[model samples]
Target chain A: AQTVTQSQPEMSVQEAETVTLSCTYDTSENNYYLFWYKQPPSRQMILVIRQEAYKQQNATENRFSVNFQKAAKSFSLKISDSQLGDTAMYFCAFESFGNEKLTFGTGTRLTIIP
Target chain B: EPEVTQTPSHQVTQMGQEVILRCVPISNHLYFYWYRQILGQKVEFLVSFYNNEISEKSEIFDDQFSVERPDGSNFTLKIRSTKLEDSAMYFCASSDFDSGGPYNEQFFGPGTRLTVL
Candidate 1:
């Protein structure tokens, strides 16, 4: 069984600043994938970024990046130069190769203050 | 430009009524999935379909929940007896391949909001 945990329930950041959302997971599988998904007020689940366990390089999508520490079982999402559009409920997900199920963290409500 | 699509953006059904959520995965994708999110909870996987059969499912998908790919393109989730707890937003997603790669991104649809009373 795999599980994802997001310790932070809510976080706020001023526009143009940076914010980091923490996430941890328990998985015995060595090879897997980590993902960050954003759900705005519209309630649409949008993929933010994804990191492959085999690759040590953290995944980056513009202002969004991941700090993946495989040994620590930690994968955190960092949003730089945050904007109002970035305000949403962010969820951390875990999925392994050949596995379709995605175990998700509780989620972190992020608010970008002007 | 390809994307997954789900029908019945919003559904209001009485308790114990059967509700069917429909989805059309990306045309070229082989893997399909159904995920649900309660009002303030994280998205939970319900089931995954591949090769014309169920590859995996979560505990939440009990005997009352069933999935079918009746035809070649549409994937459906049928809840035999809806409960208040079943009211949530259901999302459909699909991936081109399961292998980890840049293109393995799962495209999601707008989702269907099921409201049970």
Candidate 2:
């Protein structure tokens, strides 16, 4: 079984600044996928970004990017130019090569200060 | 982009009563899944369905829980006897697959909050 851990339970960032949420995982599977999901006050879980294990190149989606360190089993999300709307609960997830089920981290509550 | 849709944003049910949650996944997706999140807890996987049968299930999904794709569009999860512990937000997701290929990214629906009293 794979376990994902989000070390930061809560984080705060000023508007227009950058913040990073950290996550680490334990998995023996060589191939897998990593994902970041955001749940705002509305409680809608939205996909923020994704990273393929085989891809060494980091994935960048507009203001959201991931620093995936496969060797160290770390995948952290970086939010740049944060806005008030960026405040939300962020979850890190892992999916094994053949599995469709996603195992998620505890989550980090991020607050963007205006 | 198409998305998964779940009905009845919230439900209140008495203990021992049967409750069914409904979802309509993306039209082209073939794999369906059910997940639950207790308030302030991490999301947990309940079950996964494909080819009109169950492909995977978690220990939490006991005999009381069952899933069925009754029609071409609707996927349903039925709990024969609801328990207080069953009260949580249930989310449905779906993914597209071809042949025997590994499952790809899953798209989630707005969860249904189930309150068992």
Q: Which pairs of residues collide in candidate 1? A: none
Model 2 C-alpha lDDT per residue in residues B1-117, reported as the tens digit of each score: 788899889999999999999999999889999999999889999999999999999999999999999999999999999999999999998888544654367778989999999
Q: What class would a CAPRI assessor give candidate 2's docking?
A: medium
**Number of the top-ranking candidate, with TM-score as the measure:** 2
Q: Flag regions of model 1 displaced more than 4 Å.
A: B98-104
Model 2 segments more than 4 A misplaced: B99-103
Model 2 DockQ vs. reference: 0.65
Report the C-alpha lDDT of model 1 over A1-114, residue by residue, as the tens digit.
Answer: 899999999999999999999999999998889999898987767899999999999999999999999999999999999999999999999988666678889999999999
- Give a tens-digit lDDT track for model 2, residues A9-109: 99998999999999999999999999999988877688899999999999999999999999999999999999999999999999998777899998999
